[model samples]
Target: MELLERLFMGSPALWGGGVAHSVLILALVVALGIMLGKIRVAGVSLGVTGILFVGIAFGWYGMNVDGHLLHFLKEFGLILFVYSIGLQVGPGFFSSFRKGGVTLNKVAVLAVLLGVGTTVALYCLTGLPMTTLVGVMSGAVTNTPGLGAAQQAFSDLHAGAEAPDIATGYAVAYPLGVVGAILTLAALRYLLRVDTQREEREAGSGTDALKDLTTRRISVEVCNPAIEGMSIAQLRELALREFVISRICRAGGEPELAGADTKLHGGDRVLVVAAPRDIEALVALMGREAADTPLMRDRKMISRRILITKSELNGKQLADLKVRSTCGVTITRINRAGIDLVAAGSLQLQIGDRVTVVGPELSVAHAERLFGNSLRRLDHPNLIPIFIGIALGVVLGSISFWIPGVPQPVKLGLAGGPLVVAILIGRYGPHYKLVTYTTMSANLMLREVGIALFLAGVGLGAGEDFIPTLLAGGYVWIAYGAAITVVPLLLAGLWGRLRYKLNYYTLIGVLSGASTNPPALAYCSEQTQTDAPSVGYATVYPLSMFLRVLAAQLLILMFG
Candidate 1:
């Protein structure tokens, strides 16, 4: 304490140590974020390293932050990051809701509801307040928005009502949520033996594939025999015209911008982000052999949201918007107040309406300029249908509410309501497109950001109170966390078997425990030794993610 005081007590850093701590913590957080973004085992959001930093800081500093500032950081950062993801993934996500795809949708719906059902069942037994119980379950599903809806419901139930110790409960279990999600994935991997047999099986099928297909950036050397005498700047400008300079590698040299003024050496290599075609041009322009490094290709399309507000090209209609003409962009769909609006000829512009657009990278960038603004923003509209479905489901579940039940309503999550609905949709929705391409992106945006914000609220709200309460209860959270992971997993394993013909990959996807849908399809490919499951898996995941978010809210409400 004395040493600390001497170094920073009067160091002009803290308004009670605010400035210094903020800088340090923010930097620390950045490092941790980088690590998480860079590393994943199997298909897990294993952000344990980040969690540890937060946990250690929380333990030492009691997780202090100005409430308003913390809220702003958490909410805005989450929305920004997730909004981009939504825009990128929206169109594909929405297509999941269509006809001939209902079966996959059914599987996804069932898995999520099962998670919710387990939470409520456990909540009833413990007599825990509904909010915390619901929050934990929703977070487990990676759907924090549900917690938000639950909070709203709780407050609505009793004006100015202090929610039950949900924050505390979430704090105790979130780390476990991360771990469980990873374990679920690991279990899925182990159960299906994806790691051990993928290469061998593929080889047998005469399509040898690399397990580490995901991209990585690396430095390489390239020599231009013809351009050795040319100035570096000229080479740089030439390269820039065709390819993005990803990075540069020089002989005992410092890396700098590839400019028209820099001199080039025979052995100099300029790293670049470019397509194979661009790379060919770059080699030809350099007049020498160019080293090619590993390049990652995205199998899925990217998306973004264009908010149609007053600044959105001044009240243009869809066709009048000239969106495609302006940017080669396609209007996948539109959203208003959490409802999906199909792309139409006359859907006039309105402030705060989110238009989900899909196209190549350049096109998306152009659309954002003309439409993205300060007052409004784009988001995945997945929440709308799920929210509507859940609201309807819960109300319906409770319409014949019997007092002898789990608190208020019939427990549909435990049963097969969600899965059944998802499958029905996936199997039959070819014409329906419950989650269209645009809608998929919108859905991902909503679910990702909504859940993150809710979690931020929970972490901030519960962190301090959680530990103290846990000790008083003799630290029962450990057991509860264990139960949360185990029960749902077993259910998924069996359900996948009985419902989906018990294919190994489907089983693994069911068990992987995280919300990533692509893996299930991948897993199916691994097990059945075919690509057909990929289609089925893709069809269901977006729909599943949407339902998980929407249902989470109502489930939280029920538990609270």
Candidate 2:
């Protein structure tokens, strides 16, 4: 028993500063925290945030590691976490601002401003240190990236001195931050006497104009004289919208695959894949809906979903490929990151897209070769681009910009630099012949590991002061944090509902996204049981994340 105690708890080598000891502690913290996070109470779990608390407990119990190693792990982990997030959201970041998304983003912006304003006000009124307030604000919003950016900015300005209280403040306020958004949603529901079912039904009634543009497919018969003899390419131009001509059948002939060069004749039926909203124009221009078309069930023509694994084909437009003219096949739809887009001429192909190609079996086999459908290529992650992008990000982050009236030049810092670089790489890497495609599971693994390491380091660093500060009037931060979380959400939620007439699901999604709270988003998803909340969440999440990270840094630089 004495030997076991010394070996497990009192060994000099185990407690002393070393790389292996630090790694072992980090591994234990992450593993235990993940296991703890999986235990749900009342359908709510702490998720990965549990790592922070577990690390804190271990630290409080007197475990220690090399400070330099801990700092390095923390910063590197933050970089990985933000970079992976940027990659995930970059593809649709710009495109998310169409039509109704503009309003949703506006609401999100307002909430962010409100949160910053509240933090500033608390700093002034409560006489609390700006560092503490900034941490509390980040925790109130449940934005770990913001907390990271604030820490980076503080360190940059303060000559590498660690702010142990920052993470403590974040840890103290984080629990309510999760619950407050959900409670605000519930309060608003009761205060306004909302009818979720009716709002859901109304949302289903086609209030959004962009709904049909992405996820609908239909068949139309060709009868209009103007387009009777026009090629499919010309017809697409006249319609002024994106649609794919998958197959065409004449009155007396068997159905065959249609392509850009396929000419239309009167009394011919064609299978069109397009946005549901654009269907009306096509139907009016072409003819009427051809229900139960023989072409849909035609046995002679084959339809196949081909995975794109060719690096050279990345960012090439569908028209540029000329699959129709070369392989006698039409790509009706291209699925990227789980969203299906109509295969239009101008649509740029990504490395990981799954395209639906319709043609003869031989033609599809030929097209498959053209697309490089080798699954083996996708198994190997393109790590060169990731390292190159990170290098560029470090360079970019080190560059400083002078703002008018500021005492010091502002830098994007470690967190902001990597995030911005990753977003750009994810969005435009293909244009420059860079392969940015990562499997979903691979990206998730990178993100989880990064965040786990970062949080563990933070917890260990802050644990010593955490309990002391809480006993010394730090409990008041809960009120401050609650105010920060609930007030902006209430105002923004009301504005979205009253001004924009947003549905309940979408409004709650906006509130959750503005806060950057995944638990609240999950709660909204569970309650709605529809895609409306997800749509709003995805539309506003990218902008909100960027703004929160920037806002936290600005608060530290200007006030801290």
Candidate 3:
């Protein structure tokens, strides 16, 4: 009863005494903040960021946590959050620059540079401490890692002396930063008088140009005498295009499953799977599209989706797997991270890939066994690679580089190092025999817990000065933050539209991604009924996140 009374009464010493009290306070903050975040006002909610404000509230009411514990939780949480993000974006990070992504990323980089320039200008104009302004910039851009990076830089410079409440400036600026991005997007739509439907239509069916491997099955009847005696492999070489011959039929016989060695004879019918753009050329080369081909009507041959879960197959090429030669099944397509890829012989297999195979039922079952289609095996997390990667990240973060004129050496710090390492591991891990596949739920769980713990620490640490700072001209930080948020978005939006004539949905998505604001992305998805926004967001997110974190630390190191 006495312990319950102490817990309820909120005794400052009791609350700050040990790990149990600190954990309890953190738990309550996260729980209550999550509850508060669920209450939407006009379709916009704080989401997980509500924890920051709730932590402030707890701090304002004199809730205390042990200092050492708070610091450890905050830093560890930040590492987890950033490392998870790196893994998520690493696979597509370099590929994001292909085709149309190049243009989208150009605009996104412009937005990032413009935001940095605006913050620098504000610092010079307002005479605000760079520490505070950097915090404001991080919040205004809705980048949490940037805030963490900035704070870490400051601590390194000051040697753990009384540090300014960086999170206070972030807390002040973050809410409107979200709303401001949404407003900027909406305002651009109205000002430009964009036709969303027409823009989407003109954007080439809203298909990702990089992964345009559409599963178009064109049944063609052979008529070209030039290719009468050629193998399917020779035909592929002649066509200079990647395609799968799923089924083939003789003039008077039932359809049979096709392999690389399948021969093309005059009047033979075959079903070819390739991109839409290549269908016409393939049809011309073969003969013509046969509407009544027995290939489509074949019941003996079937297509089955096999999930790749074998660790040994992480980097094996399809040619090495020899699905067709051994299992008598042809792989038609490989789906990775929601994008369909052409299943060429040179294509390397990865864990978690879903490959579509066309063959007889027995052949497909054989192929499935070869690929290890065990969900239980895939569900098991590879913790060794993760911990090893994290350890490497810490080592990388500790190594500092001396600049030509700077007084201090520059480091990637806790946030940037793990992020960069995680991306590399995620992208090239398979080649090195490291399987970095984590279920979406597992990744999300790690990310949420990490961010929540980090935010709770920041809020509690800054709570003492939050109200005081706000009352004393800190409200102007909102105006500064708004300027920081809205101006760069508008400028980038204009440049992307006028210079490149970018599709409206893609432009807004680039803007949202440049700001690193997911709430704005949700708004973009809601406003545009196409995946153009999502594609643009994904293309820019990794680079934008890297740039934002690096910029924050540089600003503190150079100017703070």
Candidate 4:
């Protein structure tokens, strides 16, 4: 019994209380939580959030660890998680906001307002303390930053007596907040009788530009006399689409790699690499269908995935770079993040974009040099921008703005500041000579590690008193918290779907974003088997998070 206790709790007599003990407890909690989280019931899983419950359990068992270390890990983990998310969505964030983003954000704001209204109603009905109600509000949304902001506001207002209630209410309500959002998503799916495959097909059909990016190789014979003497560049201009002429073979001549300036003849057979949808257009403009010949099999021609690591190339359009005219290479496609983009002349290059360039071996090599395709450089983390972003976020979080009729000023807080800053850096950093690109593996690693640390810390900190609080009158707040969590989500989510005709996947994402629940977003993504939910989540996240924090404080000030 003593040995088991010492192993789980660490003995002061043997391995004195320090970082090692803290690390040991954290590792155990995270490992167990991850394994436990994978246990699915009705096709739903808690994911990494299982770590928090495990931490709470350990803390409930009277396990002691370093307090300061736990605090540091918790905050640092949150910073890492939000910052990584910011970087991941940063490139598309602005563009996303421009397209149907305004309406989605408005829906998200309505959801936030609905949630705040629910919390206020719960407070009035239950006669709960304002601090406890605010905590429940934060937990209902699964937003730690909101809770922190509320606590900060409480402290600023000298309502320290209600502070303990905040944490207790938060702990009791948090688990269900995570579960409730997922449940709301599930309920909507069933209620709406949503067909997942049909939704995917519908969404897919709507994105024509993305669908048109599929690379296809087609051969055409130059039967048109007008196009016979035209250069490849002139033909490309006439076609009015982004396709590449890779090789040309004239009567009684061997196939040779084609360049933008290469001239065509009446009998020439040309191999064009372009989207399948654009093939008919090109064929109509250029010539008739020709026999399939292995034109691309030229020994001197090569195709390589060139990574854009050079800052100078970042944010510059392909037309500006003129790789086709300058290096005689054709960029068939560009892979950004995980999305494949057809390499159009107007397509702007971002750092870390992998462009598939095809041309003569010499030309391809020159394009590679221009792009700085350095595998070693990609492995090194760009620490300067990361730290600078975090520093700026902290400063931004610390500043407060006074509001009319409010007792305390509202601040962006840690999560909001870093998130907002990272989004800007991800979108505009390239313009300012800052490389905000990170490899997928690195970004995922940082995000996972950060969330894990954060969950562990929260669980450990709240665990010690979790059970006691729950058993002693804190238990009722769970029901109150659940009400706060589900009411707003269901109301707003259903409204968006029924009125706005939002796609089920996108609606789920909007609910998750409005709630600021990562677990819900993860579940929605898994259920839909698409990243579409992520788009909705990312688009509304910054604004939702800010509103949540502000609303939490407003709740405290109004009712306290």
Shift of residue 229 alpha carbon in model 1, Å:
63
Candidate 4: which stretches are off by over 4 Å? 1-20, 144-171, 193-198, 207-306, 315-317, 329-348, 355-369, 373-375, 516-531, 549-560
With a 3 Å backbone cut-off (N, CA, C), the pairs that clash in candidate 2 are 212-276
- Let me know the TM-score candidate 1 reaches against the reference structure: 0.48
What CA RMSD would candidate 3 show?
A: 3.4
Model 3 weakest 10-residue run by lDDT: 206-215
Query: Which clashing pairs does model 4 show?
Result: none
lDDT of 1: 0.47
Q: What would the per-residue lDDT of candidate 3 be over residues 333-405, giving only the tens digit for each residue?
A: 8876554667889977778889999888898999999998888996788888788888999999889998777
Relative to the true structure, candidate 3 reaches a TM of 0.88
lDDT of 2: 0.85
Which scores better on TM-score, 1 or 2? Answer: 2
Per-model TM-score, in order, reads 0.48, 0.91, 0.88, 0.74
Candidate 4, 521: how far from true, in Å? 4.4
User: Candidate 2: where is the Cα deviation over 4 Å?
Assistant: 1-17, 186-206, 209-213, 252-254, 288-296, 299-304, 360-362, 528-530
Question: How accurate locally, in lDDT, is each candidate?
Answer: 0.47, 0.85, 0.85, 0.78
Clashing pairs in 3: none
Q: How does candidate 4 fare on TM-score?
A: 0.74
Please provide, for model 4 over 375-465, each residue's C-alpha lDDT reduced to its tens digit, 9 standing for 90 to 100: 7878888888899999998888778887788766666666667877888899889777788998888999988898898778868777877
